[model samples]
Target: MRRDDPIPLVVDLDGTLLRSDLLLESALAYTRAQPLRLLAPLAWLAGGKAHLKQRLAQAAEIDVTTLPYDQRVLDLIGRERAAGRRIVLATASHQLYAERIAAHLQLFDEVLATENGVNLSAERKRDRLLQQYGQRGYDYAGNSNDDLPVWAAARHAYVVSAGGRLQRRAAALGNVAAVMAPVAPLQQLRTMLRAMRVHQWVKNVLIFLPLLAAHAANQPTRVLAGVLAFICFSLCASSVYLLNDLLDLPDDRRHKSKRKRPFAAGQLSLGIGMALAPLLLLAAFGLALWLLPWRFSAVLLAYYAITLGYSLYLKRLMALDAITLAALYTLRLIAGAAAFAVPLTFWLLAFSMFIFLSLALVKRYAELREARRRGETAQASGRGYFPGDLEMISSLGAASGYLSVLVLALYTQDRATVALYSRPQLIWLACPLLLFWVTRTWMLTHRGQMHDDPVVFALKDRASLLVGLLFALIFWGAS
Candidate 1:
């Protein structure tokens, strides 16, 4: 095409130029920052879609630099602009976000976006483009069903990150200029699974500790109840994980590995995640009320409430966050006891709190170590600790771990231990093993080889696994 004959290349914002939706992004940010004002969005929606967008735009601020942009689309836009094409950013997203994105890229010659009471989308977008470029006089780049009407009216279609069916449909419209391949189904599935954090269900297995400790593991009825409780806690835990990710978006984006998370990376829409989290939580409580005893359900509710509180506010408090995390882990044990109507003794609870607190501190130490490795000297993002506090964290964590071993040793002298184990002295071997494992974990953290999640590290490490196996054998022989 000649320089004088270049058609304006109009690009859609959400899912076209960007991999995420601004409306959902803004809404989620608003909900997270002002949870009590949640109904404000619905009230705005009652006015109109444009009004809703305007209100949310005023309330929420997105870090444009962190937004995931389709690299291929950026390259295409760059090439078109270099060839003197007049690039137009025409998005249904409110003008507030659209203008910011346009300003960031500096590629859009003109920006046409929703403002005032009219949501500029679909046929509305098509009409506006026609008014400026005339019918079939402009090229449009878009990536969803909402863009089909605009594509039909455009001179050419540029499909960005659209599935095969969408590309075929766009082709049938007779103006397929180009198609950017979508992410593979298997890859998307993997991302979604990671987002849901199925692997973290390992933590919920702590719900069986009370049954095992009380020697009720062999009872079929108690075992069944414990397993059901485990499921409920797993679901509830997943919901909290999702919420944490949503709230930690900015900090996660700044982190090395967390930036790849579904919500933070823009692989999953914030709207879908916001909707799915509540459903998972509801399903968890439903199982609790239907199958578990009232006490168990109450414990589960308390666990959820405490965890939700941790995610919202407590997580920022340095030592308090670690202590709260330990309590959360101990609550799983309490939940199990409640579920199976088993007695949770003071010794077991004390041992668990100390051990889990150590692990929680290990998680923080690893985070600070990573920050230091990356040359970060200020306070860690979304955390109260600084890199300079790593030494103290290590000291406290190691001390906490040893205290748990001491608790275990003290438990051996209890009358209950003597009654439960014919050869209670064999349990002494487990303490040394526990000590070695804890020492090794702290050493790994010091060496910067530890994962930010100590439990995940334990699960993945061969040495930790062997130590755990030895403990199981020692306990089994004593029993």
Candidate 2:
């Protein structure tokens, strides 16, 4: 080829052509599909990263259509292709996934990727391109420091989604053709907050339930303990939530709203998320052990254990998953009672179990309902329910909800109710209001208007908020 001929454009797949890492993507997919065999991926890694990538690619294929591609990179590739410049897809990702992406985009004239025993990344990638294109015969597009070597060998470097430091480094190579705009710090902060799910910390407020139920508002020490418990629980819960998101990447990518989640949307790096999860958990446990009672710390450990189990295996069990979710919610209440040394009565436990169970089923029912609307006939992703199970789920959920109301009614008739309230009869009014709210919740879920998480829905719903205020008012008046 003549030196005057336009240099070939070679694009890196992970973090370059695509906004996400395919190796991490495949690993997450494999784990989600076969969580019980998690060691399988690790075992492959023991051989080499190339073996790990190849094994995961063969074990669980990612949906190329759902991958978050950098639109700017695609546009650049398109413009280059239209100019009759050859475009190549080169990467450290396994050949299996790379081929699928190349075929999906249909823009790459050639594909160079890791195969056999070789992990074609960094220097390996540079060597391969050098051998194929000769020195300065190709332009490369990449992101991250890993691409620094490849950029040095290329005639012109193109950076994608890179920060200022990376741009400066590439410029020192003295051949940067273009630099795509980076994500803003504020936007990145928002994405990180979303990934950590700070909003969901509201659920940790359940640690205060015993404080309210015991009418211990006048006791500062108990109240302070509850606040600390809430913070500890929030930190631990966020840790679990991040791990769940990491493991559920493939399923989340296929989900309607979940696809926008940080990990699934490529807004957060998998490595950073993986590191952050355990650090957060450690911080939580450190706080719990240092500040809370021993029993509270033990209860927090149980919560973590159960949540890990649910994320690992229990979530796949039919009917059992919802029951376990209810149990988890009940555990929060129990933990609260433990935190403040409050008595956890049978009435409170009974009411919590039934109500949380109902909400759990509501979550499942909503997922199945969405699957039906999406024309899916198979079981919902990472769930045991099929769309056809909607009717039964609704029936069972409504029954559990009503059972909670029955528990509340029975509690009002108890001698303890008389001891705690000036007019125990007024406590009976809460039963009907709860009935209305629970029934309305199920109705909205049935009509496909509810969020996937019922708790989140309740937090945002105006009607639910009003009912909560009224319930608080009634209880305070009785006290």
Candidate 3:
């Protein structure tokens, strides 16, 4: 074949023209849409990969426009198309998704993808290309070891990889035309850590609430148990974060700020998240079972189950979502009490529920306000909330927060307060500070200045920190 001949440029879809795998994307989407039918994918896969892809494609609705496409690959294809080279989109993904992506890009002259019964990949892809273009009649761009066969048959190969390992292997075929640079591994690692949401572990500090409330911080063994409980809960929380991110991939991609998240942006692989979630959960349970009391383990297990439920279903229910979030936060305190074998007072539980419920509502309010800012008049995606419900939410959330303060005020006057604190009246001062913080939080949320997570916001907010310090001093003085 002459070098000047009109050789077509064929691009692989997953990890080539796009930064994500369609199979994994569709599978996750399917899981999110029909969580109850999660085991159905395994059954479909029993038939074959193509069959699995086909079933997922039919069940899951993927928005191709929002998918993470490789800009470099798009630019390359654009250049080739302008130069009158035929551009083909060849992917192992389902034909449904392949066609949709091709239609969205509008740069492919034809699409060759998995259809009917055959998965158009590896040897089959190579054979198909050979049958269409003869030897050395086309150029190819691909990623992954699965594309090695296609690369060997192409007149020119374009490698898309984060590192040179794949480039070195592709170059061995003696046809490498170019290499597309990918994000550095270190940067990708940081993004993956962000996906794990290590910062949100601050919420696990609630596990110390029981210790603090019981005035047992001076007890060395109790402190150690609290620390261990925090670690176990943090691990379990991170595990839930991973699974939630996986399930919320589609919804996250639609959100303005969340779109940049590692999983949503395709910076991290779904398979990694899937594998790490269960492993982290196991580690959390193992540590709890070995070191903590059986009651603590039970509480941790309950936390995981409820959180999993919230991620899968409860989160889509309007008021119930906030209630579930509050319950999760309260469970952290319960876990702490269980860890230390401390008696959980009714006052503490009531205060925790009301306060955390308010915070949960703040989270939802912020999301709705953000959606309104984007000029969306429809219901919040993947949530059972509409922008119009903002006022009612604010009303209910503020009232709930104030009720917590009322609980605090009443607790200060209780007979138990006299038994616990020498200067019980000093505890009364905390109620106004609690009220002030709650009011300010709602104000910021109403103004769309609050983070999605109120606990995380409190960790970073100067006002919230100052309030926390004052509240702690008041309690210490009372004790």
Candidate 4:
């Protein structure tokens, strides 16, 4: 080590001083946070490390409260800090979270982590380290060859684990100290699968199908009630999603895609997610009451019953599994109407089936497309589709498009709808336009741009916006 007083100690965040990467843990924390990117590892196999890193980084997210860290490791850091060494916890992890860990540990004299939107990696860490403490001489600890550039640049190095690939890389470097810890076991497979976000049941908010269909029909109170009902359902649904993610943390780790989730990746602990779940449920139920004080709690109960069943066994059955989900979605629309004490027309129910069936098919298509693209067999695991069925998906999508339009035509022609509209004839124009819009929406999905969540997509897509605005204008004008 170079001669200098008050040495600076640098530490890596993931697989170093800390137990696991918090970013991965949180990103995979949701039951539906998994959208795509299972194919990125295939890219890795094709020697697209940089591309894989880029894709994985997009998937990276962290909820600090949920992150896991051994108390013993924290104590080690605390004692080191008491010794008056200038301790720095540095890593390629996002700076916001790295700083959070540093603050929680409260032992680091300085955090040499990524900050100002820069990651501490290779030359980046080296440059900052050299510029900041080169004249002072410092000790740095890390765990990968990726850490080599900075380790070689440091005055002294603590090479933790000198036997793995990282150890071989450290062999050529002088000033290396040998200290290796036993590897922590991988997260449980079942827990990891839950983390993969296969069942994002809460986004079923679009189930306000009946109310939206009769939006302009002089049923403002009823429409508002139904909308509020769906929103209530959404909050409750999200609470369930959080709980499922917590429960499935163990299973999620077995799959390549699921291992990156918060619990499975060892970033977030099961306890925190579990603790957070009930609080969310409380808030959700409270919101439900505020939205629909007229006894909408029953809907929440039903949702829970059906979803818990789906999570336990329905999800594992091939064709019936996804169909169960479709039924659940349709049920939400029905429940919304029932919550508002509004009766639905046959057309309204049929429209719900058409739209949801299309969405279900599209979801399957996206997942299968992702599987094929990634060379993963997961889509075929308890799934009914194969790569050769893309054309069938398009056909099914077209049928749904036509059926959705037909449902709307029947709805508009109905006496209730005709009475609701101020200019009922102008409303007919909306049918073909809506049909085109629906087809276009699915086309975008087919092109791989369908954001995983359709409701969010409707809110985000410009075309969906225009179509919606036109519908609103005609409906309001007619009323």
Q: Report RMSD (Å) for each prediction in the order shown.
A: 1.7, 2.1, 1.6, 15.7
TM-scores of all models? 0.95, 0.95, 0.97, 0.54
Q: Distance from true position, residue 204, model 1, in Å?
A: 1.6
Instruction: Between candidates 2 and 3, name the one with more favorable lDDT.
Output: 3
lDDT score for candidate 2 against the true structure: 0.90
lDDT of 2 at 327: 93
Best by lDDT: 3
Assess each prediction's global lDDT (C-alpha) against the native: 0.89, 0.90, 0.90, 0.64
Residue 290 CA displacement from its true place in model 2, Å: 1.0
Q: Name model 1 segments beyond 4 Å from true.
A: 1-4, 163-168
lDDT per residue for candidate 1 within 1-479, as digits (tens), equals 55665688899999988888888888777876787787889888999999999999999988888888888889988888888889999999999899999899899999999997889998999999999999889999999988999999999899988888888889999998888888899988787778889999998888888887776689999889978998999998888888889888878888889998998988987777788899999999999999999998898899889988888778998799999999999999999999999889999999999999999999999888888888889999878999999999999999999999999999888999999998899999989999998898889889989864888878889998999899989988888
Query: lDDT tens digits, residues 22-112, model 4?
Result: 4444344322344344454565436543343344444544444434454545554565566666778777765566677777656676666
| Candidate 2 Cα deviation (angstroms), residue 237 | 0.9
lDDT of 4: 0.64
Worst 10 residues of 2 by lDDT: 1-10
| Better by TM-score, candidate 3 or 2 | 3
- By summed lDDT, the worst window of 10 consecutive residues in model 4 runs over 26-35
Flag regions of model 4 displaced more than 4 Å.
1-231, 247-261, 286-295, 377-385
lDDT of 3 at 109: 95
